[model samples]
Target chain A: MPPTAALSIRDLKFRYPPGADDAPAESGEGVGGWIVDIPAFDLARGEQALLTAGSGAGKSTLLSLIAGLLDPDPSHGAGTIEVAGTNLLALHGAARDLFRGRSIGMIFQTFNLLHGFSALENVMAALMFSAIPPREHRARALALLERLGIARPNADPDRLSVGQQQRVAVARAVACGPALVLADEPTASLDPENSANAMDLIQSVCRESGAALLCVSHDPSMAERFTRRVGLRELSAAPAAVGG
Target chain B: MAMTDFQIVVRSLTARRFSTVTTIITVAVAVALMLTLLGMKDAARRAFDRGSGNMHLVVSRDASPLVAILNSVFYANPPRAPLSYAQFRQLRDELPVEWAIPTQQGDSFRGLPVTATEPEFFTRLRPDPDREWRFAVGRVFRADFEVVVGAGAARQTGLRVGDQIYVTHGTGTVAALAESAGARVGEGAAIAHIHKEFPFTIVGILEPTGGPHDRVLFVNLHSSWIMHAHDRRLASDPSVKTTGAADVTDADRLITAVLLRLLTRPGQDVTAVEPVVFDQLRRAGGFTVAKPAQEIQRLFAIVGGIHQIFVGMAGVVLLSSGIAIMLALHNSMEQRRRQIAVLRVLGASRGRVFGLMVTESAVIGLLGALAGVGVAVVGQQVVASIMRGQLGLVIEPTVVPAILLGVVAATVALAAVAGLVPGVMAYRTSVLRSLKPLG
Candidate 1:
């Protein structure tokens, strides 16, 4: 009762279908049949955790699973993934999409900002699926971009510098004011200084919004900034890492 | 504010402006071609129908009924054979006809066909039902050498009321006749095979009737007879210096065709007794009795195959454009997988993605079809001008709004159907795989 868990995972198991080599596997985990086998995991509300893993360690795959982009392989085992006190696995189709969009925000290393959209528009796109009134979307998006030190919210994301683009992506992720935020190697493409700045911006934004943060990275140095740290090898019961 | 689905579709199309515009133009060209063919065909049929006028039957010595109507009603060609004055009298007396007007052709003024008939021809004949022939200037020819010019003829030749014009013997242009005859007469060498001795004064100009009649010059039958008799006299003895109307006798009087309106019972449709009169005239023999309406229908039936072939060709073009739309969108899908995946990741359902693709295609088609309608309208004027100049057949601008709307709606539906393949490609896009950065 002290603190509600923003994201709770229990007895989660996922395996790639045989010959499903669409994505590169790390450490021969997909070939060995169990990419993810976690017994239990939880992040308290407003908590920030850094999950470190080597390359191809299924870090992105785990992020995808929590975001409802990919489903856990139920053939191996049934699992429960609860986000904001709602069972994410129970939702289907558009309901699942709405739940993910409203309750979770994700940032990628590549800064997956929608092309052909301005920085403000990328953030507004997140709010499009939220419960927020459409009339207030523009002002909210502009305020968020300004808060992130984006001088020109109308500028195309592609025209922005690498550091600025990441900040824009960070804005998009938290635009909906989701309860939980996920980062899959969010600073992998940045220089050391830019990476530190991106991490600081993301963490500060999450703290301001009272949102929990789970950032996955192969870089060992990322653990120094987080009060909570978990290793992929310790979290996943797979014989090897998901891919690396 | 969040952009609507329509706004998103528009933005996506604008991002690939080259392909979108190319596809729209391809669709526009196909729609224009199809609508133009349809419009011209409808106009031609109406012109033919209007040319028939109120005539129940056209009796001529042509080979067939359709030929008789074309030569007598449309002036498609000058009549080769002439019916004697005695035969015209006999037909007027014996046939169950209300008004029998005899018309003689084979004369021309400045390349326009010249038709000579009685004054009753102007008063009794109508260019269209419920529309009487109205004079634009002066009055109908009442004297022997007086003439009435049609609206189109007056405009083309610049002949006005009281202007004198020498009528030529054949349908050839003055230049062509001069080139053939090597004879130069008149101030500008304008006299070529023209019966210069008998200069007819234009006494009247008729308003446009929107039919082949608009391009004709009308003269009295007595004037034509007198001119021909003088030609015969001059041919017999090249020294014959003068000839007058007194030289024309009953033996020399001839007319090419007789336009007949049958005597119908009170309140009875002219078509009701048309077949009976047609059968009776055919049985008597010696003359071609053609119902102008029936002949027009037959002409349409004969040309219907060619019309269908053109329509089929246009449909093929439309189908090819649809395929172009499909290929254009499908090819773009290959490069747009990541974008589609991103949309899905942003909470756009698969159905939403599918709908977006189809809506984009339909928008392109709607725009293209609207543009095509505009092109067809301008194209119709050019086509109508050509037909008027070359065939002397006036084509009314016949762009029916219902037909246009139907074509536009069909094109949009066709484009939507074309988009289905690409929409499916987008719907099946994997968010997880596509989110990975491409090498």
Candidate 2:
């Protein structure tokens, strides 16, 4: 029998409305011009996986779908995304948001640390929605910032170097001890040396917390760092990708 | 412990100091005006009430009730035709008069009205039947040339017990203007010059009453009569008797008005006395009766119309300040879009975002209102000073807690409403587009 997957996506299909004003045109797998079609994807507990895709290949959309930030179209889409035994697609609205906050963490390319908050405060902000006790929030946040090698935990994010800011983002993402951490090209803006360092820090932190890591990157150097590599074209290919 | 959302709000406001201060000042000015207008309305009504006193009726020459009341009680407005001193005596003898005080106007000292009456004026008159006038210092006039100054008059002139001031026989403004203009041949006008020959010493200073009495000078009736009679005696003969107060004997002594307080048995209805007194004055032909309370109410009706206009203008100012708050939040929201999306990604629900915005506006409004109440109190005092100096109308600005509380509640409600549109828009902001990477 297969090991239980910490993150799973099966028989998924999604389509963008034709010429919709706010829609970004995604032309990949054309199952009646569906924007996304994937089948049988899984990440074992504490596994690290990398996904590579060119522009408009539905990389960001897939990340959004897994994060429960976007709702799948019921008419053309039929799928279940389960993260840590909870089916994300089954939840709706605020409930989905809460599950995402408690069980899933996201890292962005821009190192989206709140400008007004310090390095420690940015991590503490994530714990506010978690089940962590209020008394432990500051101590936990301080400990994480120290572990991430941030020299100035109380320094404002705007004053931090690019590499330090990325580390702070990583600390924030894993602060809640979420079951899965999604990284959307987190090192896109960093140099090769800093990029390698950022990836190592994210992977090491996830491993220590026993959280699964799914990262999307265009940089070829990142492919060797992950235990598994998958192509967007492979995930979007026809028939069997939709359980046919 | 987790940092409260309020801490974030305060940080955001202080980070943008200019907008916060401008919004507060806008709200402060609007609130000050609202309090000033409302305070003036209340104080004006009270001043009229204090001046009404125990006397219910005023007897004067036939004229409008407003003219009669203003001339007699306030010693303001143009002097009405005089009622004979003999006629006042006749009414005192025939009517159920407990006491009658005859007052002659048409004279002033340093812009304060000079009222001439017998010594009974102070001893008998009471603001309420239970209370008589109290003096702050010294004693009432005993000698004919001695005078008692009201609290306001003393404050304005800085006069003490020994300071002597000459009364202008006609009106202070007209006499000063004519003397400055250097042309006056009228006999009545010369009376002001004649009175300068005899100056009266200020012997007493009355306590502050917040009434028209606080702005007037009180003197013996014989002193006024002697001054005017001495004008004629000097004009006719070079030598006239000016030895004592008795030399000013009554011949054609006419007074401006008489304030009446009727005698009644303990169980008798005092209100019933007014109609009989009115009828007696009506039968006496040349005289008319005016009720101070009723006439002052009419005065307020006219003044109240002006008050409503000012209140409407103040409401517009307050409403604009609410708009200023709305604009401030809305403009900041544009800069804060990504920050809001970040909060949502961290687990804040849409409702939480909405609440944060509303609370920000409420904080601004509450702070503005508190500052406004303080500004209003100071503004009202300035207004009171001006009214006393220019109009001889005494109005004390007193804080009414209920009104201030109402202002605070209204301001908060206004701020909440102002923030509603922006808050709802923020609640609807799509988290997907905002969080998407360069991909």
Candidate 3:
């Protein structure tokens, strides 16, 4: 009855290699490691949530599943994961990849900007797979960088400071106007000032773009920034917390 | 952020500048080798195709056709038994001839063959009918002791018009014999160098003909008789004398070969009647008949065989270049894993990643091929100059554009194939695994 969820997951379970503990690894048994088990989770359109976890609590694994980087293990897992109405678990391989590129924006912890590209080119490249017309890619990228307070949009990534680089990464993430923004430990390397600035910049940009934010972090202090918060230990269905 | 496939390729290659340059150079060398070899074959064929168009027949004493062509046209190899002056007269009087000019040799001015012939030789000889020999400097030889230098000979000797040059009798094999004969009895058996009493003056320099004709010194046949008599051995015979160009008896006159041009009757095809006349000359038994054109054909066959072998070697080089591209891409795939994973997360399909790798190789191949062609063009200019100066064989520095385009296309295609292994490797890369920190 409420606004449709931007992301929804239910009865989700995954284990690497896939089976019970009794069978041999070759037979897809003990080789399996419990990665994710979520009974239910949802993010309504335009809502922001922060997901926190310890080092080994499968924060990345869960992000990967939602991004369609990894498919849920069919035999040892059962689940439905949907983003913007497309069932993530139902798609496979390139279909999932296209959907991710088209509908989701991802920002990683280390500010993974292509080293050879300029700040503006990095953003434009993201829009290459989007529905944006090629002629407008330049203008859109310039506007995004200008809005993010990047003075040198055409400067190479390495030439920029860490704060500038992180801003470029955030600009590239939202370049395609994706419905969901997934930032994984986006401020892990920043000082207090830079971290706070990066977080403020990311949330404001996502909100303006009307994208729901599902940010992953190992730092519990980050939980205070978001209205909704959940832990990987609770979501992964593990009794004991794993060190991040 | 999603980078386009092309931007990714350019950035990746530019990042490894040294490797990319090496790959491009490898490709360039292979392409240049191939194009040069091809250009050589084509140039050789063109040179021989127009080798001796005016003198289709060489009538001389019995000898191998190849040897006769080499001696008469190229001034190479030893002198054959001189064709009798009587035979020259007979052909002049009886045959339906358009023109017959005799060439006499066995003398040299600074290692260049000195041919004694009538002035008609210059006026009548046309290697290509559209191109006639004109004086680059002065006029043709007019007097008995005057000579005309060919373009190549003049360039090599640095001789200009009005330079007096002494001629030595029998410069090649007979130089020693002539020198020994000229030695005085009291000289203690040391051979004396004989130079004619009257030195010939250079009267003209001929323009380049791009053939063997461009490498000789031409004088009136009378000057040869005057030089031959200077040898002490020939002075005693009384047969050698300083006769005018118009006043020479059969006994005093001698020639090496007679170049014939048969007359074509109206409404009659010279090509059709040529064989019949050739058979008559063969059966007549007084003259040895040879077609320089046919001899050149045999030479082409030998040259063509060598050309094929060299081309095969060039092909091997190109193949190795393709392999080098493959190895370069494959080796870098491991390092590029994180980059590829990042692209996948940005909506690049495995196919897109695969295509990016292949396209990268193709770009390299294209660059290499273009650079190689440029090298070939420049290299040809140098080689052609050497060929003109040394061999008097002009090789055009140009190649067929179609063939060049084909080579470029082939190079790019081979490079794309080279990228396949690396493309597949990137396609199968595990995005999740590569993103994990290595142990």
Index of the highest-TM-score prediction: 1
- Top candidate when judged by DockQ against the true structure: 2
Predicted structure 2, TM vs. truth: 0.91
Cα lDDT tens digits for candidate 3, A173-237: 99999889999889888988999999999999999999999998766678899988878666655
Could you give candidate 1's per-residue lDDT for residues B1-439 as a string of tens digits?
A: 6767887788789888999999999999889888988888889999988887778889999998889998888887777889998889888898788789999998887788999999988898888766889999999999999999989989998998989988887665653474356454334223447777888999999999988898999999999999888877876798987777789988669999999988877755364666787888889888898988888899999898899999899889988888999999999986787888877777788888899999998998988898889888888899999888777789996887777888889899999999999999888888877878411
TM-score for each prediction?
A: 0.92, 0.91, 0.88
User: DockQ, per-model, please?
Assistant: 0.48, 0.49, 0.38
- What is the per-residue lDDT of model 2 for residues B1-439, given as tens digits with 9 covering 90 to 100? 7656786677667766898899988888888888888877898788787787878788888477788888888777536487778888987888888888898887777667888887888887874345588999988898787899999999988989988877776666566654445444245433343265688999999998777788888988778787877766766786865535555556537688888888766645266677787777777677768888888999999988999999999989899999999999898876666777877888777888788788888889888888999999999999999987866678888868888888878987898899897788778877766655536
Which scores higher on DockQ, 1 or 3?
A: 1
Which docking class does model 2 fall in? medium
| Model 2 agreement with the true structure over A1-244: per-residue lDDT tens digits | 1246788887777766666433554445455676667767778778888988787788777887888877667886568889987889998877887788888889999987876778888888888888899899999999999989998999998898999999999999999999999999888899999999999899999999999998999899988897688777777774344211
CA deviation > 4 Å runs, candidate 3: A1-3, A18-33, A76-78, A238-244, B1-4, B61-63, B78-80, B168-196, B232-252, B265-270, B283-288, B437-439
DockQ winner between candidates 1 and 2: 2
Ranking by lDDT: 1, 2, 3
lDDT of 3 by residue, B192-242 (tens): 345656678999999987777777899987777655444433446656544
**Local accuracy by lDDT, each model:** 0.84, 0.80, 0.79
**What does the lDDT read for residue A52 in candidate 2?**
81
